[model samples]
Target: MSRKVDLVADLGEGFGPWRMGDDAQLLDILTSANIACGFHAGDPQIMDETVRACVERGVGIGAHPSFPDLQGFGRRDMGLTADEVRTDVLYQFGALHAIAAFHGVPVTHIAPHGRLGNLVAVREDYADVVASAARRLDPELIVLAQDGKLADAARAAGLRVGIVGIADRAYEDDGTLVPRSEPGAVIHDGEEIRRRTVRMVVDGVIESRNGTLIPVACDTVLVHGDTTGAVVLAQQIRVGLEEAGVEIAPLTDWLE
Candidate 1:
């Protein structure tokens, strides 16, 4: 059977006058959007606009919560206790939920952004707390994380799981996310990204940065919205994947 892939665009630009991503254009190319909440980068206006845009484009909406570090764009790692992580995650996620609700758009899933996302992928205690926050908010909200124990934990807790796979990064043998600072971490070549993603979907496998083939359960594929040429990349990916006979749907369809 041809594998189905959900393309998630990380929408919601920067706060105030400084815009970070081409959210409006990117939305058209993706199946779903991981909308940023206030903690990481987006502002009230940005969130509202993002939600509205998603609704207009018929995109599946999901909360993209992050650590409270807009200055660092939520990519910088700040060591925090597990409880602290949970609290921050829920706080940010809730903001987006309300914003989406206000626009009459039901949030379909929850995807952690930047540092917070990396933390939850491999940290057992931190993952537990973060997953707990999602479950507490709504058991039906799928938690988008690297497809593995994290997804399993969320499922075990009765929260729907969206196994989001990435082509640029890799998971170490210990399950910790490979830091982006490492060499060859980010896949800049568009062809490579497409090839990796195709392999992941068709074979349920991806080559780690360490050159090891690892099994990955991918329901959604994340394309970073902030990167330059991200919109073009998403378009290319969508066209290429569809041409290969892969169905592009939202998180809800895959989870259901």
Candidate 2:
């Protein structure tokens, strides 16, 4: 059977007067969006605007929650407790949920942002807390993550998990991403990224940094919009997948 996957990007990552990536361009190439909530990089205006744009484009909306680390772009470990993590996640999810509701669409999924995203893949406690938060808010919400603790916990909570494949990041043999501090952790070549995305979505496997093939359960692919030439790269990835006969659809449509 031909593979089906969602093309997603992180959006609404702008603060007050400052913006990060060209969200408008990314939105045009995406089937779903992991929009930032207030705690990470979005404000009320950005969140509303982003969600509204998604609604207009028929894109699935997802809440991208993170630790309250606005200055660090949610990439720094704040060492928050379990309850803190849960409440923070719920708080962010609630804010985006309201915005999405106003835009006449539901927040279809939850993807932890930055540091929290990395931790949930490895830390059982954090993963369980995030899963609990998702279950509490909306059991039907798909949890976007790698094949790890969060994926396990979400399934355990009786929620559908959408495995997110990131083609630009280096992965370990065990399916964990290599830490950013490591050399050559992030892949920058556009052609390589496009190739990787096609392989990941069609073959259900990714080549680890050490040249080992690792099995990955990919239901969606995240195309980072913050990189240089990101829009072009995203466009190439979408084209590559389509040419490879992979169906690009929203996770909400096929996650379960």
Expressed as tens digits, the lDDT of each residue in 1-256 for candidate 1 is: 6667789978885889888878888888888998888887888999999999989999999888888888888888788888888888878778888888898878888888888787677678878887788888888888888855567779889887878887556667544567888876677888888887878777888787777887877888888887778888888777778877889887677666
| Weakest 10 consecutive residues of candidate 2 by summed lDDT | 247-256
Stretches of model 1 off by over 4 angstroms after superposition: 170-176
TM-score of 1: 0.93
Cα lDDT tens digits for candidate 2, 1-256: 6778899998899999999889888888899999999887999999998988888889999999998999988989999998899999988888888877777788899999998999999899999999998998887999999888999999999999999999789999888888888998899999999998899988888999999998887888898767778889889999999999988898777766
Once fitted onto the true fold, the runs of candidate 2 whose alpha carbons sit more than 4 angstroms away are: none
User: Who wins the TM-score comparison?
Assistant: 2
Best by lDDT: 2
